[model samples]
Target: MPIELPFDDEEASTDVDLKTQIIRFILTGAGSAVLDFGLTMLLQYGVGVSGGIAKACGFVLGTTVAYLINRRWTFRAEPSTARFIAVVALYAVTFGVNVGLYSWLSHLWSETVIYSALAFVVAQGVATVINFVVQRAVIFKIR
Candidate 1:
């Protein structure tokens, strides 16, 4: 299903302002983040997955959502096989960073729910910045 945001580019596919693109990207990321956090928590506490494993699973869902929304709404890029593969490669790199940091932080903290969530947040924040910069400048640049 397509999500129509304020800056959606159904008519135009290029010449978007940077600030506008950033706003749309953030909105897309926010929606993805909700899914990520919810799934992470559910898997961690409810399904008894380890914190790192839960976060890895959640990251996959979250980034996949982000890619769909960002391609259509934020960057307004037409789908391409090459672009998709590049994005998958980028996500693979970020996944390692996110999961590694999450695992390291989880080990430092007590196994309480709050600590787990906090660690996830920190790891997610780092990965978010990296994802945005790389996606905007390299993966989905105006072209």
Candidate 2:
């Protein structure tokens, strides 16, 4: 006798390796960070927004990019309000974590630009890990 899947076998590959998925998310996020930092600087320099305000604007932009990428490309989640809310809540948690650490670590580096870059890396890195956990356990879990 042969085993039968509950769903049709025509579905996309379900065995995407966890490690690969995380790496893909990171790479996508890295691309998004460029937009984040670039927009932050443009707002700060050209528009003269304060650091905190500029960071907030950039974060929103970057997070939008991340959400679209993660949902459509990385996780390929089915559309649902509960899943969307979970992603937002998870990001909100990571947002505070990212901002706090970025502010603290920005002081560690000499050049402000360099400091900002490193802060983005560190904060985004932490957020990425948290996203993986949340996405795997809650957000993207098939139920």
Question: In model 2, where is the ten-residue run with the lowest total lDDT?
Answer: 1-10
What is candidate 2's lDDT per residue for 1-143, written digit by digit as tens? Answer: 22222333344333567786788688878888888888877876668876566767787889878777766556655556777788789888877877667667766665366677777678778877887788877788753
Stretches of model 1 off by over 4 angstroms after superposition? 1-9
Clashes of each: 0, 0
Cα RMSD, each candidate: 2.6, 7.3
Pull out the clashing pairs in model 2: none
Best by TM-score: 1
Q: Give lDDT tens digits, candidate 1, residues 13-92.
A: 74667898889888988899899989999999999998888999999999988888888778787776777888989999
Best by lDDT: 1
Model 2 gets an lDDT of 0.72
Which pairs clash in model 1? none
Q: Give the TM-score of candidate 2.
A: 0.78
* Superposition error at 130 for model 2 (Å): 1.3
